[model samples]
Target: MENQKLILVIGGTGAQGSSVVKALSESGRYSVRILIRDSSSIHATELAALPNVTLFQGSQDNQKDLHAAFTGVYGAYVNLNGFSIG
Candidate 1:
């Protein structure tokens, strides 16, 4: 695992995020950690079952959760939903 880069992915069960997670997980170059609102969800469960992948239960609005999820990760992929610049 030390040889692979660690990436933290937000909204990883969603359409766009899932694609990113799938590509990265299959590449063998990254150990992926995904932040999901519900770890028990079917999508989350499937992702958790994949090799070199981990699921952390939390929301993007929670700073504490994000801090924990970001720990030791080399990079992050964030997908925001219903976000507006205003």
Candidate 2:
């Protein structure tokens, strides 16, 4: 991986996102930034404990937030949290 490349991880506090964070962080390869709606949320706080993990306020519907989160991002992992129809 490139040095200091930012990877913006959407829904990083949820189940799948959390696993991604762990894998990325443990590898010590890329920088991970988590986009969360609430900074004070439990999952947000948990993710904040990991090294090289930055948490910022963001939402999918808000284009501005998405843009801000993706600024200087070398990669992005978008994890939609809604349930799917069977």
Q: 44 in model 2: Cα distance from truth in Å?
A: 0.8
lDDT of 2 at 11: 75
lDDT of each residue in 1-86, candidate 1, tens digit only? 78999999998988999989999999999999999888999999999988889998888888999999999999999988765312
Model 1 bad stretches (over 4 Å): 83-86
Taken over the whole model, the C-alpha lDDT of each candidate is 0.91, 0.85
Q: Clashing residue pairs in candidate 2, if any? A: none
Best by TM-score: 1
lDDT per residue, candidate 2, 1-55, as tens digits? 4586789998787789999988888778888988888889888888888888888
Worst 10-residue lDDT window for candidate 2 reads 77-86
The C-alpha TM-scores of every prediction are: 0.91, 0.88
State the displacement of the C-alpha of residue 15, model 1, in Å, after optimal TM-score superposition: 0.4
